[model samples]
Target: MSSSSLPSSQKQVHLLKRPGRAPLSTEILNVVTAPLPDVSNLASGHVFLKTHFLSLDPSMRPSMDPSKKSYRPPAPLNETFWAGGVGTVIKSNHPEYKEGELVLSSAFGAQEYADMDVAATQRNGFFYKIDPAKGIEPREYLGGLWGTGLAAYLGMKEIAKVKKGDRVLVSGAAGATGGLAIQIARQLGASYIVGVAGGPGKAKYVVEELGADECIDYREANFEKQIASLSDRPEGGMDVYFDNVGGQTLDAALLAMNPNGRIACCGAISGYGGSYEGLKNSFVIVARRLTLQGYIAIGTFWPQDVYQAAIAQLATWLAEKKIATRFHFYEKVGVENFLDALKALFEGKNWGKMLLQVDPEWKGEGSKSAAK
Candidate 1:
C-alpha cells in the first residue's frame, strides 16, 4: 500500500446493471480485473490513489437507479461504481498533494485505484485531509467524524435546533446515523430522548449503549402506542424528532410530536426500494404545526461557515468524550460481500458505521488510525 504495488490488472466493481425493485444479486454489480490507472502521465490536478477503506452506505442504493431524480446523478453504467473512500497518495502530479498523504474523497470508485482530481473533489465538499496530529483516527473519519457524524450534527444541531429539556425522538436508533443522533441529542441537552428501532436487541443498544432514555421496538404491534406513551409533553408528544427511517415509524412520530415541534428529515430507508408510502399522517404536520426540513449532507445545501463549524464541533465532542461512537467493519474479500454489506444496511444488520477495507492486506482494527 505504500506505493502502486498492484499487478498488470486489478479487480474492480462495475455497475453492470441497475437493481430496480428486483432482488439484489452479483449480476447487478459485476467484478472484473481491470488495468491500473496510468500514473505514467498523471492529469494536471490529479493524484494516483490506492483506496484503503470504502464506505458502504445506504446512499449508494439510490444512485443505483438511473431513473431516479436525486441530489446527484446516477452512477454511469459499466463504469467503476461511485463511492466515498479514504486512501493513500501513491503518486501525485498536483502541486499541493504529496506521496504518502492520506485523504478522503467523494467518488473514489469502489476499486483498488483511482486517479483523483483533488481540485474537483475540493470544489465539491470533501477532499478532506485526515489530520493525524489532531488525535482522531482515519477510520473514525469514515465513521462519526465524517459524513455520518456530519449528518447527525446537521439534523440535531442545525435543522432540529434541539435545545435543553427538549424531548427528542430518533428513528433508526441502532444504525450508524441514528446511533450518533442519540448521543448528539444528549450533548445538545435533550432532557429525555426516546429512540425507535427495529427489534429488542437494537432497542437495548439504543438505550444502554447509545444513551437514549428508552428505545421502542418497531417490530411490536403497538409501536406507535409506545411512542405516544413516551411523550413528556402536556399533549403527550415529543418536542423534536430526528428521522432516518421513513415509513410507519415516521407516521408514528408524526402522531407523537407536540405543537410546533421540529423534525429533521434525514432519510427514508424503509422506502428506499420504492414501496415507501409510510406517511399517512401528513395532516399531523398541519394539525400540530410542525416544521420539517429535508437536507443533503457533504453538499452545497448549507453555508460553509455553518457546516465546517458544526463538523469541528462534532470532532471536538468525539475527542473530548462528550460523544461516543461505534463502527461496523467488513473487510472487502469477495466483491459480492460489498453487496451483502449493503443488504445488511438496508436490513438494519449493522450496529454502527458500516465500512469495507477495500485493501485486502490491511488487517489492523481502526481503533487506531492507519497512519498514526
Candidate 2:
C-alpha cells in the first residue's frame, strides 16, 4: 500500500512509567493512537515503513527501567518504545532503500508506522535490508538468524570459543537465544549438549527438537543435581557454558564447570526487575581457572567484522537446514498487547522467540494462542 493511502493515525505502545520490583503491568505502558508519520517531505536517505512484527525479549524488560545501569540506554518514559522489527518500506527517498522493499531494523518504535532516516539508522547501527527471495520468513530474522541467533553465534563461537567434542550447557534453553544456541553448539561439534529449561515440555522440546543431548528442568528442586548427572565432568566437566539465565543457573553451571572452562555471559534475565541472587559458587571460577566474558550483540562490545561474519554464517546455516527456527507468536495483537507479550518473557511462558504482530494482515505460522 502507498503511504498517501495509508491511515492517518497509528497505534503506539509508549513507556508510561518504569516498573517497581514487581512484574510489569499495563500501567507501565500507554497504548495510544498517534499521528502516522508523514513521508511526503523526502529528507535525503529516508523511508516510511509499516512494521510487521515486533520482537519481544527479556533484554527489553531491563531497558524499561531508567535506573537500571546497562550497556544501552533505558527506554525513555512516555516515548514510543524501541525494538527490533521487520517491516516494508511504503515510501522512500533513499538510494539504497526502495519502496516495497522488506527491511529489518532495530530502531523501529512500538508503533504501526515509522519514518526512518537510512543514514541516521546506519550511523546509529540499526538497519538492514531483507531479501525476500532468500526463502526465509521475515519473523525468522527477528529470532535465530538476526536477533538472538546472532547473539548465540557470537556467544558460542567468539566468547565461549566452542570447539569440536566440547561439552556445552545453555540455560533458558527453550527460549529463542538458548534454543538456537543449543543447535549452534551441536553444529559446532559439541559432543554432549545439555539444556536447562523450566518444565518437561520445554525440556523435551530442547532435547528432541532443538537437538540438545539432554535438558534439565530448572524448576525441579534437583536442578543442579541434574546438571551434574548429565554433564561429562570427567572429560574436563562442561567445556563451555553459554549463560542466558543468570543467578542460580549460573551458580549451578559454575559448579559443573571443568578446569579452564569458558563462560559466555549473554544475559541475566533472573535479575531483570530488581530480583537478584548472589552466586555462591563464584569461588569455583577462581578455583577451576574458568574464564567468564560478558558481551552485547551490538554497540562497541562486539566488533563489526564479527557481527557480519556471524550473520553470513547464520544465513547459510539457516538456508542449508543446519539450524531451525522456532517462535512463540502473539498473533494479530495490537500495540495495547505489547506489555503482556513482554511479560511472557520473564514469566517463562513463551516456548520460543516471542513476537508481537502489529500488522493485522501478516499471518504467522506459529502458535496463535498467547503465552498463558
Candidate 3:
C-alpha cells in the first residue's frame, strides 16, 4: 500500500485523567482520533505499524496511577495508554524489519496505528518478531505463548522452584496467567493441584478443563474451610502457592502452607480496586518458614537465559498439546471500548485472557497473503 492510499487519521484511547478509588470509568479513558503516522518521516531503525489486537491485563490499572510505585513507569495523563499488541509493519526504515512482517511489542499504544523505534523497543526489553512458520496464532503471543505464559513459567520454575510430588495451589485459577500456572504445575509433576476461582462455572473450567485436581470457589461462604479440606498430604499442607488474588485468598493459602513452602506472588487483583483485605495469617510466613517472592515479567528483571529457555519449553509444550490456551476476545471492538474491556477484569467477567480485536479482518498469515 502506498502512503497516499493509507489512512490520514486513526482511532486511539487516551488516559484522560487519573482514576479515583472507585472502578474505572469512561471519564478517565476516552477515544480520540490522531493523525496517522507517516513512514516517510520515520528516522533510522523506525517502523510504522497498523495494530491488529490489544492485550488487556490487570497490571494496567496500577500503571495508570502516578502515586503507585511499580517496576514500570506510570502512564502519562492525556497520552495513548501503553499495552502489548501485535501489529503488521506497513512501512519500515529499519534494516532488521520489513513491511508486512508481524511483530509484538509492549510499547504499542491502545491505538489503530503506531510509529515504533525498533532500537528503543529493544533497549527497553519489550519486542519480539512473530515468525508465522511457528504455527502459533499472533494473538497467542500476547496471551499464553508469550506474555502470560512467560510470567507463569518464570514464577513457577524460577521463583517457586516447583518440583515433583509437591502439592500446588493456584489462586485466580481461571484468569490467563492463573490457568496457565495450574497446567505448568501439573507438567512439573505436582502430585496434587488445587485452583481457586470465583463462581462455579469458572471453578469447573479450572478443574475439569485445565486438569486441576481440585477447584475451590472463592466466593463460597466456607472458602477457608474448603481450602483446608484439600490439604491432606503427608506434609499436611501445600508446598507451593501461586497467588494471583492476594487478599483473603493469600491469607488462606498461608494458613494451608507447609513448612518451607514457596509462594510466587504474581498479582493482587483483589486489591486493585482501591481496597485491600489485610492478611490475617501473615505471621504464618515466619512460623512456617515460607519463602515468598514477588516478580515482574519484564525481561530486564529476569536473566536472559532463563527467559529464552522458558519460552522454548513453553513453545514445545504448546505444540505437543501438553498445554492448552484460552482467550476471551471482544470482536470488532473500537478503541472507545477500551475502558469497558478493562472493567471486565476487576468484575471477574472475563473467562480467560481478555483481548480487544482492533481489526476484525485480521487472520494472521491468511490476511497477509490476501493483502499480497
| Residue 193 in model 2: lDDT | 88
Clashes by residue pair, model 3? none
Model 2 accuracy (lDDT, Cα): 0.83
Backbone clashes per model, in order? Answer: 0, 0, 0
- Candidate 2, position 9, lDDT: 88
Where model 2 places Cα greater than 4 Å from the true spot, the runs are 228-236, 363-372
- Give lDDT tens digits, candidate 2, residues 222-256: 98876765445555679899998888889889888
Compared with the true structure, model 3 gives a TM-score of: 0.94
Q: How does each model score on lDDT?
A: 0.81, 0.83, 0.84
Residue 305 displacement in candidate 2 (angstroms): 3.1
Query: Where does the lowest 10-residue lDDT sum fall in candidate 2?
Result: 363-372
Tens digits of lDDT, candidate 3, 1-372: 555568889888998888757568878888888988666788888888888878898888878785555456888898899888898888889898888899999888899888988889888857778998999878778877666998888889999999999899999899999999989998999988899999999999998899898899999999987776555555577999999888888988888888899999998888776866788888889998999999987767777888889888998888888887788875335666788889877788888788877765576532332234
Candidate 1 stretches greater than 4 Å from native: 1-4, 231-235, 331-336, 367-372
> Residue 306 deviation, candidate 2, in Å?
2.3
